[model samples]
Target: MIFVSLYLFMFCKMEENSGHISVADFSKHLFWDVNKSEIDLMRDRHYVVRRVFSCGLMNDWNLICRLYGIQEIGEIAKQIRDLDPKSHAFIALIAKIPEEDFLCYTTKQSTPQHWNF
Candidate 1:
């Protein structure tokens, strides 16, 4: 009974983790606004790429690139309208894409410093 239970437990653990990338592996501070475990990579790719590339460190950047590739990441990042200039430039350079090709660059907003409450 003990041997069978142990085997089952290990097998289940392996099955659950096989070829799956969980958000929990990212920097904890990056996901403070949401429940980390509920994030599905395929379904939540836009959110994941936006958060990791915008707010995460180099390691996080490398991880996402390895998992999703530069082409895919650039495609997603280009669509985000509010990405900061620094982050936008970084991705544009690494992805080897012209700045004008990005939607964010083509439709950038003027500085919001003049807005009043």
Candidate 2:
């Protein structure tokens, strides 16, 4: 009886730790937020963020897509639009613009070198 009780306790704890990662609409996961903050600190130090790509497990890619206005079905479309000839030309034009007008995604850190934030 004692052994059975101990096994059950350990099993429950494991499940709790791997609790269902339900994708909340807008509210970020409290635990994930904490982890991100730590990662940001490491990034400031230029330490672990360079060594590790992505640390914590992401809940669901689909949820992020929906929130970002790019649903799963439209993902390919979104990609195509980004790389469209017109968009490419626009980006080229913008690249020629002065630094003050140049607004683009920072490539200083690739996904492999991305911190949680």
Candidate 3:
């Protein structure tokens, strides 16, 4: 009975953590504001903003399309499909951008080891 209870507890803990988006994780990884338009980000030359358009994440692509009033989501999706059909569409697009760009946008105060990646 004790072993069975412990096994169930561990299973539940794993399920809770899987695909869970914690606030700290979201803030640390995604530096861009969802409310900001693509034009505003372009004018500011934000790294994440630029990459989100060119990158493969469907969620980011859709959000940018909606925020910017652009109708290029399908086109972008086609491009991503052509490039890597096996890639995960919903995962965060942080790894798509170059490390240099991340370092440039990330402050030391916010991300102490930003350059390590």
Candidate 4:
């Protein structure tokens, strides 16, 4: 019982520090349609962080609450709101990506059938 409790506590602490989504995980979910090269470029250029921040800020509160939990939403909002001007500007730059782009990235599509000659 003691070991279980300790493990649970550690797990919660780890989750708390990592935020609800890490850059890598957020990238996977956001850019599911993009090839690995694009994903790699986004990661290398810190585009993942920008996208996560933009999604967090622009997405509805209900969605945010669903993803991060009701309790976590407040903390996440506060952290983003508290970001310095320079950091906020950087996030805003990438946040300009169109809603259509997000939709295209997340939408499910059937695989194309190969043609035989």
Candidate No. with top TM-score:
1
In model 3, which regions exceed 4 Å deviation?
1-48, 54-56, 71-117
Lowest lDDT sum, 10 consecutive residues, model 3, at 83-92
Q: Of the candidates numbered 2 and 3, which has the greater TM-score value?
A: 3
Give the per-residue lDDT digits (tens) of candidate 4, residues 10-117: 444455433343234443455555654455522333343334444533233223323443234323323342233333333233233323223223442354325412
- Residues 1-117, candidate 2, lDDT per residue (tens digit)? 456434533443344324222333223432344444444321232222111112212233222222222222122222232132332233233223322221222222233423332
**What TM-score goes with each of the models?**
0.73, 0.19, 0.24, 0.24
Q: Pick by lDDT: which candidate is best?
A: 1
C-alpha root-mean-square deviation, each candidate: 13.4, 18.4, 15.0, 15.9
Report the candidate with higher lDDT, 2 versus 4: 4
How well does model 2 score by local distance difference test? 0.29
- Model 2 per-residue lDDT at 15: 44
Candidate 4 clashes between residue pairs 3 or more apart in a chain or in different chains: none
lDDT scores for all predictions?
0.71, 0.29, 0.35, 0.37
Q: Which wins on TM-score, candidate 1 or candidate 2?
A: 1
Q: Kindly report which residue stretches of model 4 are placed more than 4 angstroms away from their true locations once superposed.
A: 1-24, 27-29, 36-38, 41-45, 56-117
